[model samples]
Target: MNDQPLSGLTVIDFSTLLPGPLATLMLAEAGATVIKIERPGGEDMRFFPPKSGDVGTLYAMLNRGKRCLELDLKAADARARILELTDAADIVVEQFRPGVMARLGLGADELCARNPRLIHCSITGFGQSGPRAMEAGHDLNYMALTGLLALSRGSFDAPVLPPAQFADIGGGSFPAVINILLALLQRDRTGKGSRLDIAMCDAMFTFALFAQAQLTTLGHAPKNGADLLTGASPRYRLYPAADGHLIAVGALEDKFWQALCDAVELPDLHRDDRRDSEACAAAMAERIASRTAAEWVPVLAGADCCATPLATLEDAFRDPHFLERGLFDFTADADDTPIPATIVPIDRAFRGRAGAIDPD
Candidate 1:
């Protein structure tokens, strides 16, 4: 028997792409029954590259625990079927340009009328009602409007993409999950549902917590690489090693910085805060490059600098620490196919071996 947090909850998912799917995926992970509605063919990510045979690893990963029903919403019969299904759903997640749902007769106003207690959530690129609501966009475009794109280094002139999709997953997916859960809690009191409109552009804007803080307190937006955590301080940044590997340093506190300087035998830099920070940064880089990453790993690990060697994504899987924490495990497909997956973070006792969960 399996025990999960959302054992009997039912989610009727009409959303596609990353944010909506990822939100429902997390719900599914916790044993919610998520019915994945697909087109006659499949999802857009099916065309995504890096496939494992015929199935896209991307699709399989995001949509593992859901049942897919192929339907062409434009067809009258299929639309009716979808409406019927919605009546029995606890939640409906749809991500589309605004008016698409209303055109399909699945608009929130009517959906709630069909089922008085259904939580109807709409995930959109801009929003249901906004100037940019109809504009097409991807992850990068989402961050651009949110000002998160400004945090990373631009080409001495232009903004660059950050390492991850801050807007799509962080803002949109996480917020949708949070609100839906909150709605569920509220429903217990009001015995009514809600209509949630999640705008990717607006959602991502909230992710710029520190960046916005600078604007509010400092009177202007922070420039590229000019903020405290964005390589502005030598204490909290990456340094190249002698062998081209990287050392991640986060010695922000005076005590930690002192420990870092002592570990490196560079007492001169212990308290020199007003020096030409650029020159100091370059000099520190060279000093770091004088030793191999492996050589300095133990040295820094012994220090109070909160420092460590930068790790490659693949290398992270083999890292003894993650393994010990049960971050990965084997799962079987319906046809008895074995699949490798990483465990989402949660208290250990709340999950089965390899992070298997059943809300029971």
Candidate 2:
């Protein structure tokens, strides 16, 4: 842990919920001293349901390695304490709406002025100057505003909610972490700090790169579930097997597609899917539906066709490949009982010791 990448750094986290907390969690895992400043009663996430002992599972997972300080920022003493911390802090992460921090006399400009080398990262639903900057929003709202939700929709009557918080993590937390690190590198050279504006909606556009390219070139928007990678092609889709489990197919390349056709014994007319995609997809579905996922597993496993049964959460947790990779080596304490910590994408070389933070 002596060689941890962020060993000597300190981060002041004034954010709550998934995006900001998850971002600081990564920094904490990298050996930064993250002090999470919460309100007098603590953040709302602390009281969220499905508690493990006295701590919420989600809260414990997101805040595993960070120290907590209860502070009512509106109070004079609280404001004074924050200023004192800011003077010595290397990074500050805040998730308030635009102008909230400035109104409290704790804006990035004020804090960065105090700590010349500090990296101030602001994560918001919209950029500080945008028309929607002050508008109330969440992960779904950000995804909707960026056209990401329309790309892979459900039925006409009801759209499907994303299984994960793509905007919160991919858009907000990831960009904030990347920028903060870049800012630190910049500070090392320039001997000055910089403020990063991470608007979750702004980053969501990157997720739609393929759709945007199609729209730009064809002058037409792709229909929901009809785009090549969305669900239109037989090569890339989910087929329900006889036992109700689903088989995920990703035979996109010609070789893989040919292998899939051979395994399913697809008719020649449907083999060239580009000629009539709907027919081809139907034929593929019929063949896959005839057998259970277990029955098809061995047949597709050796075919190199990129086809496999869809796994549930339990299946994923017990996956042999992930277990061998040491993905669950780290543990977080829930009322003194150790549980697998949230898996982060950081490399083992850059991470600190397991259970590095004091849970108390």
Clashing pairs in 2: none
lDDT by residue for model 2 (49-163), tens: 7788877778888888788888889997777899999899999999999999999999988888788888899999998886899999999999988888898979979979999
Error of 1 at 74 (Å): 1.1
RMSD values, in order shown: 3.1, 1.3
Best by lDDT: 2
Tell me each candidate's TM-score.
Answer: 0.92, 0.97
Tens-place lDDT digits, model 1, residues 199-277 = 8888776777788898999889788788778878888889999898999988888899778777877648534654766
Error of 2 at 226 (Å): 1.6
Position 313, candidate 2: lDDT: 88
Clashing residue pairs for model 1:
3-358, 4-358, 4-359
Off by over 4 Å in 2: 354-360
